[model samples]
Target: MTDYQKQSPMQAIEVNNIKKSYENKYALGQPDSKEGISFSVSQGELFGIIGPDGAGKTSLFRILTTLILPDSGTASVDGLDIIKDYKEIRNRVGYMPGKFSLYPDLSVEENLKFFASVFQTTIQENYYLIKDIYQQIEPFKDRKAGALSGGMKQKLALSCALIHKPSVLFLDEPTTGVDPVSRKEFWEMLKRLKNQGITILVSTPYMDEARLCDRIALIKEGKFIGIDTPENITAGFNKTLWSVQSNKMFKLLTDLRSHPFIDSCFAFGETHHITLKNNDLTINNLCRWLQQKGHEEIIIQEIKASIEDCYMQLAQNG
Candidate 1:
């Protein structure tokens, strides 16, 4: 038995064989919306589910939040059964959906107060829990939620989610549309919240953000590709990755991918990330080959593997 199974009862969240589907009936070849998904989040741990837009992240979140039920499986939130104790689970957890779901016409303060009322709590009662986020948007408390900038709206939504002092928080792509600065600020807030002992389950499509989590599960096409700490995940990538650039970037990508010795090639920032199929692949040989192919200003160097690289590897293998 693994550590997870031995401590299953102590986890803040537990999901076992959770499966869901949107098909009305057996369509000979339709895939289940989500299949055989399972994972656990420990108390006060910042666990992240990283994947692309259609990778069943929202489905998993909806199931865990009790807003939607899985077709088959068992799950628990904060030690309470998700199905049998949904009411209690709802009270003990907070949820922030991807889209701005707050009342558009209501002012920021009004929205916060309304959510507090739903939980039979007041903003003043849990003011300390969300002080940092609330302070940033308190200056415009009277502004309509829809009128606030993307980042401010995000803060307001988070403030409202924490009004009841829930033990576990679920944020689904909370920084999807926010600016880079706000994205950084939001992560900082999460780090602080984790220190306050709130177990957080956050999902994001950004690979860079995966590094911020204590541990991350990479999901793709309705299944998990890999799960581990960011450092471990990247370090486990057993490949010779290189960052290559040339005057003809498009041609460089095309040519490298087609090369017999290259395993994979994809554009990454200003350069293309290349993986060699053979262990003997070298930068000097690659540059010389590209030069012979009419490429100019060719630059090639071995680069450290990143979470994105690991994710791609998992996707390919699975």
Candidate 2:
């Protein structure tokens, strides 16, 4: 076949219309954990699955990492079928679950050595791959895995996952419980790994983390609401949003929700973000209405869109 006709070996991860569900007893009156989900991650790309709790990020990661099977549809890792090549795929992928799943009683060094042994390799053989991460925790090598702090545990878990030298690394909410400094450190480690050409797929509920990935898929209610570069996703927001604040935030929020011109409004940090039904709404009109309602020290200003804003908009529409 000619070069144009030949299939390109680009995608390191491929998920196509996958679906999974549990019995009602397990579901708790919710939809399936995964619903017709589909996406791909290019070779060496750091792809992110951005979603909140119970958004099916874990379920999808389980399927891709060969720990569970999808009820329908298909997925592949390193171009190998998830089902047919489950064994081979297991050897080719590294997965750090959302929760710390390492042996609690084991020391840091033991945990790393155990995982490497299970993969038929030794820490000495692949020590270079995890050297940067392992070195940080090496001083505490004798500490039991369960006794470590959140950030230390995170690094240890990541180190264990990479011991196998897998081509694609799947991290499910790796930074969920870590402190701000540790979260920042964890992403820096990911960036270094990415530079080494390891394909990384991470999922997180924190919208701020989405910007760190090369591309992100915003998942909600067991489906993708948006998928693109962080910048592009923020740019795709079509409405004019404003930051609103007042001396009485609670009262201001209630009043804003009651306004007929408000399209969507939600508390964002110290301020509330609201979009109008149309761009024709004027700040003066809102200020006048709020003033009449006894609101004081009202502050309203148009603001640039953020990933959080985009996710909120999608959740509202879908």
Point to the candidate with the largest TM-score: 1
Candidate 2 residue-wise lDDT at 296: 92
lDDT of all predictions, in order shown? 0.90, 0.90
> In candidate 2, what residue range of length 10 has the lowest lDDT sum?
24-33
Alpha carbon deviation, residue 194, candidate 2 (Å): 0.6
- lDDT of each residue in 1-318, candidate 2, tens digit only: 233214454999988878877763221113544448888888889999998898888888888988888877888999999999999999999999999999989999999989999999999998899999999999999999999999999999999999989999999999997899999999999999999999999999999999999889998867888888888889889998999999999999899999998999999999999998986679999999999999899999999999999999998998
Candidate 2 Cα lDDT to native:
0.90
Q: Which pairs clash inside model 2?
A: none
What is the RMSD of candidate 1? 2.7
Model 1 per-residue lDDT tens digits across residues 165-222: 9999999999998999999999999999999999999999999999999889999877
Give per-model TM-scores.
0.94, 0.94
